[model samples]
Target: MSGPALPPDVIEIRGIRGFGRHGVFEHERADGQEFVVDVRLELDTRPAAASDDLADTVNYGVVAEQVHQAIESDPVDLIETLAQRIADLCLADRRVTATAVTIHKPSAPITVPFDDVVLTVQRRAGEST
Candidate 1:
């Protein structure tokens, strides 16, 4: 067959925010905090596109659940770590060719009042390989 046609890969999930303790300060983990996550997944969906089957493509719902599970595991030292982990998970999906994971920490325990602390991480498939 001719070179596999480019797949239409698209995935976006927003809001799926959560409240938990993830920080370095002891008080942060003790009192807990809130966090928001926005994720986007990119991949070659040629198979799913042709088959029109969810099973043939990466599922955003499942991705969201996986992210939730990672953040809920326990308090993290830094948002960067969380971002990296989330990105890694996205890349784990065989169908996913690239991913962008952003973690928003509102009401961060900062001395000065700020809107929010956001961390964005982008990763592509086969990064480790």
Candidate 2:
């Protein structure tokens, strides 16, 4: 017989907006633009659920703050780097087993009209940092 099943819990935060200086162009880097970040943390929620305690699970509030800080912290040439930074931050919490991060640039310097430019990345625990 199979043992007790592990809880598959995910905490998601979407559409987190912040101003950042990130891009290849000097103008883009000099002048910051709005960036939207989305994060998903996958973990077992059984402990938190069973104990009804916030300490047992990832605190999404803190996650949001960390993500925002990461975005506003430094200047990067690629959204991929930003996404990786966010993913690292999410994985910092021991409770999180994996995470996916998406970054959106709505005001990319493109002559052609487009909704947004986005990049998404996922990382799992025990993976290379």
| TM-score to true structure, per model | 0.87, 0.94
Worst 10 residues of 2 by lDDT: 5-14
Could you tell me which residue pairs clash in candidate 2? none
Model 2 residue runs over 4 Å out of place are 3-7
Per residue, candidate 1 scores C-alpha lDDT tens digits across 29-115 of: 888777889998987777887999999988888888988887777677999988888899888878788888899988787789689
Which regions of candidate 1 deviate over 4 angstroms?
A: 1-8
Model 2 Cα displacement at 53 (Å)? 1.1
Estimate every model's Cα lDDT from 0 to 1: 0.83, 0.92
RMSD of 1: 2.9
